[model samples]
Target: MLADELQHKIDFKTKPLGALGHLEYLAHQIGMVQNTVSPELSNPHMVVFAADHGIAASGVSAYPQEVTYQMVMNFLGGGAAINVFCRQHNIAIKIVDAGVNFDFPAGLELMDKKVRKSSRNILEEPAMTSEEYRQALENGKSVVSEIAKTGCNIMGFGEMGIGNTSASSLMMSRLFDLPIVSCIGRGTGLNDTQLLHKIRILSEAIEKYPHIETADEIAETFGGLEIVQMMGAMKEAYDQNMLIMVDGFIASIAVAAVWKKDPQILNNCIFCHVSDENAHQTLLELLGQKALLNLNLRLGEGTGCALAYPLIQSAVNFLNEMSSFEDAHVSNKE
Candidate 1:
């Protein structure tokens, strides 16, 4: 369908012009994405990439690194907020062990795609070798390819890793050329002194990489396995023409990395929320995009994906199911 035709359909939806606000835009976008005025959502999925970061030992985050594994178990056991929201929205979530520091028995349901126990400290060396980075990207592509085989077309990216916020902050600083202090934020509820310590640690870490400019250099220099993998997954999802849902802060950094690789990849992305993290709003504005919701959400385990799913559904429903003025036999504007 032509873009003008899609806009006409949205404008005649038995309501005032633009009465639905963002929903009208969402309906038009989805119609364009699917190349159908009556687009239907199917097999909505969320993937949470879990890893451990070396910077967790440097006192950047309030939570211990062990919480990464603990939360993986929480996701497996269906006891986390992502679980609740996905259950409510009928979206399936998959937890991938991108590079957590722990090992699980073979009987567990997790996808054992670990690249390493943990990435190397960014303050000392590159997070992962070039080969490892390539492998992580391929592993991510493999995961999404399998999901696509199952006919899942809509996907969201989430992440879990202690000290990942530090990685994200450093990435933002490098990507936007913004000051490190502007991108830093409290992770896992850091108190005043702990937040100050995080700032100091990240500032020192930034000094180690002075010449990193390209996307690959910035990503390899300071990315968690989960973040890099999420970037790959996002690229693959866009390649398949699937709808991409982006979660909060850490997850957004992964999306940013994908944007660096190919700016057009964003055409398929629906940013799920504006994270409560301080830098998240700034990053969103820099990208010239608006999220579907706010809710002051900072939890990263794809919670925004699940919460935003209903609104996406509403957009599809109105476009396909709601009658236009002619269909409803209502009078049109003279």
Candidate 2:
């Protein structure tokens, strides 16, 4: 049930019990999950799920909802920054139409998992119906399963939607019992008046909808197709004992959803980075995630995850390569 081989490798090659600090610990965790000291990080995949939110029309985000559609086009054309970075890092990127409102043209490997054309107006009502929420959950699980079948155990998730930060802020405020002031931020460059309006819109959303008592209730009301899908994917990864890397703020919200269902899911996650978003810290703290990086990055297209892969690889690499005082014939410290 434990990683004896990893312990053997660590004890045989490394310094003292943990001279390598967190790297030693990280290697141990990876080795245990992978069941080998000679563990390999196979096929790292990043799934950038695109969706449209009705809240965008209300001026929640500085950018228009059309950006989501246009961004997806950029992703398909390999013109996005994430695409370029992923290519440089050798991380395969897959773009999915989780619930982009636009009828994306054919040819991309688009998954048919759209819940609705788009989410309901958050100003008027909860985002999605309970049935739609369940469907989103299933679709998320299905995506992870597809990746697992492809021998990809380690996966990362990201999202693209204009008003999603507003939704995430609302979710953070409600889910963590934090004040809107602590969670809301100037998403996509909101001006002073627009920032104030964002705070007000989110505050009103909370007052109108109130707290969500269950996971399904939360996802049903506040979840996007992309967000809930990441939740389901993470749940599936946890169930299967695979490693799941979380991207930026919106991707991190999926982990919060997973915790909303089962708090123990944090064991399977390696939070890749901290974000500039104000609520991101609170959400990560609530999940008890001491994320691997504090890059102040708010770019939410698996960029953090891509940036984190080499760090993880380094941890694992050093674990298996670094020699002990005995092996190197060096003096040991007391």
| CA RMSD (A), model 1 | 0.8
Question: Candidate 2's residue-wise lDDT over 73-150, tens digit each?
Answer: 998899987898789888888887778889877777667678887788888988998788888889889888888887
Clashes of each: 0, 0
Q: lDDT per residue, candidate 1, 1-334, as tens digits?
A: 4689989999998999989999998888887778887788889999999999988888899898999999999999999999899999899889999999998878888988999998888878888899889989989998899899989889999999998999999999999999999999987889999999999989999888899898888888899999999988989998899999999998888888879879988788899899999999999998888999999988899999899999999999998888999999999787
TM-score for each prediction? 0.99, 0.93
Which parts of model 1 have CA positions greater than 4 angstroms off?
Answer: none
Q: Assess candidate 1 and give its lDDT.
A: 0.91
Candidate 1 residue 24 Cα shift, in angstroms, is 0.9
lDDT of each: 0.91, 0.81
